[model samples]
Target: MATWQCVKQCGACCHLDPAYRPDLDEYLSPEEMELYLSMVGEGGWCVNFDRTTRECRIYPYRPRFCRVEAEVFEDMYGICPEELNDFAIECCQEQIEGVYGDRSLEMLRFNQAVGYIYKEG
Candidate 1:
């Protein structure tokens, strides 16, 4: 499958959703952790993303997880800033299902899932 064309100069993904790693506190080495903590703001968006430039300050040494390739039919929810909330929920549910299977007791509510992790942090 061909990869999707990501919008260049768009910071949609940064605002789309946050990724949670139980090992976020463990996997990252000291320097990596410090860099991430310094770059990520309250909800994990790049701290230095200039809305005008739509760029990250630490793009070169961005976390390994941040280097995502756009996959075919990958279900983009962050193409437009306005749809970020809904897109985040869809992405989260997809991830939850992928990990815990389709039988998770956590009832999937699209709206409720949007920014859900933000509250936990």
Candidate 2:
């Protein structure tokens, strides 16, 4: 497996998904919070991200979630390739079920079984 540190110039994570966790609400300082909210209102990417520079604008006051280093799971299959594929599959399945009905339960169970093996190993 290859280990990598975010160059910060790459905004891949921000563009990968739109569902950001709200855990950051508590970590922002007053000024940082204001800036975050303002950026969010403008329909920009991550609140701390600089779209032009593709770097974190508020690195000093970044939330814990953002500060977390890319982990083993993240690097697994080389820079989270497998995990990203799994995430995409899960998202598609969820959307399909939402539009239709709960049809992916067996697939979900299979994924859970695989996840348990991965976790235990």
Candidate 3:
């Protein structure tokens, strides 16, 4: 089975465009919503994301909404621990595909890291 793992230098999740996530209020609390919006910078990328480095500047202290922990996923999306792997993988797949093309290098790296095998259709 495939496991979910974040790929290095793949900051696709940092593309925090509110336009694509219209249901932000549904999942995040009021404070989180505000913080989430505040993090959105030019081109909808996270303000803390260093484009050149492809890394989060505030990674160590990033908001709860930015974490991929089981508890955080449970609270935000009602995802149980046993389901976290697939759920996180799916979320990453969609986000990465949206931020970058499905065939982009980021997607390739993410799939390999997660042990996800796919074929072009």
Off by over 4 Å in 3: 119-121
Q: In model 3, which residue pairs have backbone atoms overlapping below 3 Å? A: none
Model 2 per-residue lDDT tens digits across residues 25-116: 45555675665555552343566667788677777866433443335335322336545545544543443344334445533443444342
**Model 2: which residue pairs collide?**
none
TM-score of each: 0.38, 0.36, 0.96
Worst 10 residues of 2 by lDDT: 1-10
Evaluation by lDDT, superior candidate among 1 and 3: 3
lDDT of 3 at 73: 93
Maximum-lDDT candidate: 3
lDDT of 1 by residue, 1-121 (tens): 1112333454544542226544555445677567666666745556766656767666776566455433311332124644443444555455555443544543233223332432333
lDDT of each: 0.48, 0.46, 0.92
Alpha-carbon RMSD to native, per candidate: 12.6, 11.6, 1.3
Writing each residue's lDDT as its tens digit, candidate 3 over 1-121 gives 8899888788988999999999999999999999999999999999999999999999999999999999999999999999999999999999999988888988988998899988669
State the displacement of the C-alpha of residue 59, model 3, in Å, after optimal TM-score superposition: 0.4
- RMSD to the native, candidate 2? 11.6
Residue pairs whose backbone atoms clash in candidate 1: none
